[model samples]
Target: MRYLKYFILVLPIVIALEAQAQEEDCAFKLREAQQLYDAGRIETIPEMLQACLERGFTQEDRLAAFKLIILCQIYADDLEKAHAGMLSFLKRYPEYELTTTDPVEFRFIFEKYRTRPILDIGAFAGVSLTHGLISQPFTPFNLNNAKPKYTSDGFGFQAGALFNFYASSNIQISLEPMYAQSNFQLVYEQEPIEGIATLDHHEKQSYLYIPLSGTYEFIIGKFRPYARLGFQLGLLFANNTSSSGIFEGPDEDNLENRNQLNYWVFGGGGFKYKLNKSYIFVDLRYNVGLNQYLVSPDKRFTQPNHNWVYMYQDSDFRLNSFMISVGYARSFFNPKRVN
Candidate 1:
């Protein structure tokens, strides 16, 4: 039992030492291969480094090995093998960009391939500030003596995933499926038969939103600034209403007679900061509702509690919002020659 314990403790150290020794051997072999290449002995370089290239070398060492082998094949007039090696290198490091120190022959071969982003998958969470645009105002209690006002009450939250497809270097078409919540408040002074009073009503709603947009990007160094225009389709799934002040009612489920599906047109601009093949971005957008009327006029007085207890009625209005979000995205690429 004691021996078994000792063996367990020593096993990891033994494996680590063996790994270190193997790494040192691979490093020595790489240096030897480089020296052979310089001395005009390119014939044996590929065979000498094949084993280390497979598993023994670190990432940096593997890059050097691949470069050396490709250059060797190029010098030997083995253009087919050289091209194959370049393809492998690109598959291993898709985000690699050209540097001045690279050989002209390498640059020529690299230029033959295209490595643009094919897709980007990302997620974002943010806040929405919503306001109601009233087309017709209505009040059941005060027909002429009092006026009503609608205002955005508080911030609502939203989160979603982004599926962006690249059409070209500068254009991307994106579909965003999101879950969003919106809130607004209604306030008015009431002149009932007894005296003057104030009433307040707040509504909260949840929706499933799908937006399709096309974005144009201005690429400048590591910063990419972009503008997008799109339309969105939304389905209202849940809603709640609360009344307070002069006439207070219990919180009520208010989904009845509400428009289930809504449409919107939006425009926005933002920028992305690149990190290798990933990015951090900030986006700002404004959405305008296309459906002018949110509540059906025929069903306005159907909810008895809203009329008698809250002393309220539905107004013909549209919802508009401004949103700001921060997110991260990972890009994928398919490198191939444009034929």
Candidate 2:
């Protein structure tokens, strides 16, 4: 009877020691998960601590585990689970504050999914430079005498809006629609033919430009630098030209019609700075045309008296330009959340 009473007294103490050991083990597992996450071994944490998260952790440790799981989901591209985890977090701790040690990736996902949209809108305005290229027709037994010259300072203006779609943290696609006015001066250089000297002319054009581009960006703090490449389609709305002091209007008013459809490939780089929920950006770009322009036979200075037998003639003349612009943009989200 005396030994039986001693056994009963020691049983509760032994049970308490075993419970303490189990709790210590759970804490160790939680700490290990955190270390793995900090070391960028996110793929390993779920396999290692998923069971411990459900088994023996305290309330504080459980909260930390859930936060880590959310982060892991984001990194793993498991957005659906990350969103659900965020909902759970908000329900449990409605007033939780993010600390400085939080990862930037986490903040980006949280802000976008919780408050902003995947699309951004941008606006800009800047100067443009237009260059005209002229080449001789390929033929046998022909002299390369007729040369078309252009003024080097063909300055212009451009203004536009950029519709940006975010594909990832470092990449986006932009569709820009803009209006531009360009100016140029044309000169013909050739040896004196029939006592005629060189001729000078002027041209001014207005176009609607549409461009689609892909951008890759590098982010540092509130500033971002990006490179973009794209193709643009231009539709001529108005064109006016004067040769040897005689004036000729566009297709609508002139006897011969000029090429109204222009397409080219463009590339550029720029920088963006964050301002509240909006961004301010600056861009510079160059465009190269693929097709030549068709000039009117009546205005061909090389054969000045050439009758208008044909309205348009194919010439090895192309258009190239440079552009720079500045703009502002902001993000929007649906299902608005209360701040």
Candidate 3:
């Protein structure tokens, strides 16, 4: 009789522990799916999560698992699977509402699948025209009071995605996250004492950039003219500097003249030609740098003024660029007009 009573007391505890362990297992599986998705393993997620979605122990786990599967399918370019998954999700959770925490891309796709709007997701690539401006102390070593000089023009290219959010008939917000290859040339000229008179330096840099702009449109027949005002941020990734003449030393890599980060305020006007739901655009913009491009060193050079070029130098230099780009994009979501 005493053993029977003990058995009765332990049975409920064992059952509860088993249930808890099952719940934990389900949570772990869902987390694993999320990890794979976040790690850019889009193609692997569907297979890895099939079992979890089929056997989800709770409503939250099933919902999360389904969403992951649908997202993975969309990224993998399997639109048919994505559409089917989304339909199934809606059928399962008819009252579920999307939150702000969800990925904007996913929300955009879902809205397109439901109620369409004038939304665009586009990719663009174009050439760039950059003019570098360097400002120093006007001959810090009192060489001649000559201002810093730059190349006439350096050429590069930029590529990125353009997401256009149309608010109304005459207004839209265009956000572009891009990668740019910017190259520049700097020249330091001195008295022609020898063959090595001018120090010509060329720098090639890579940056990740994003430009957010508010645009206004004026329709004229088939062409739409628009103007935009915005700011851009550029994060430098890699820099390579090469020199010739007097500036050429054993160390060709000079970290002293490079800036790791840069930003600019920009404005421009452009025109677009409409063709059904797709359009081609050409934009011309000017960018002005807001900060110094070089860092000042702590140590000073006590050597002769001629050797001053090798020492740490400070300058008030800024970047400016005139860019002309042309690309095409399509409107994927166009909402119905209410009359």
Q: Using TM-score as the measure, which candidate wins?
A: 1
Task: State the local distance difference test value for candidate 1.
Answer: 0.86
Candidate lDDT (C-alpha), each: 0.86, 0.70, 0.69
Question: After aligning candidate 1 to the native by TM-score, how far in Å is the CA of 158 from where it should be?
Answer: 1.4
Clashing residue pairs, backbone N/CA/C < 3 A, model 3: 117-333
Question: Every model's Cα RMSD, please?
Answer: 3.2, 17.2, 17.3
Top-lDDT structure, candidate number: 1
Model 3 lDDT per residue over 48-97, tens place: 76766665457788888888888888888887787777767765654345
Cα TM-score per model: 0.85, 0.58, 0.57
lDDT of 3: 0.69
Local error of candidate 3 at 139, Å? Answer: 4.6
List candidate 2 stretches off by more than 4 Å.
1-100, 103-117, 137-146, 188-198, 245-256, 295-314, 333-339
lDDT comparison, 1 vs 2, better candidate: 1
Question: How many residue pairs in model 2 have overlapping backbones?
Answer: 0
Q: Which parts of model 1 have CA positions greater than 4 angstroms off?
A: 140-147, 188-195, 218-224, 273-277, 301-304, 307-309
The per-residue C-alpha lDDT of model 1 at residue 250 equals: 87
> Number of clashes in every candidate structure?
0, 0, 1
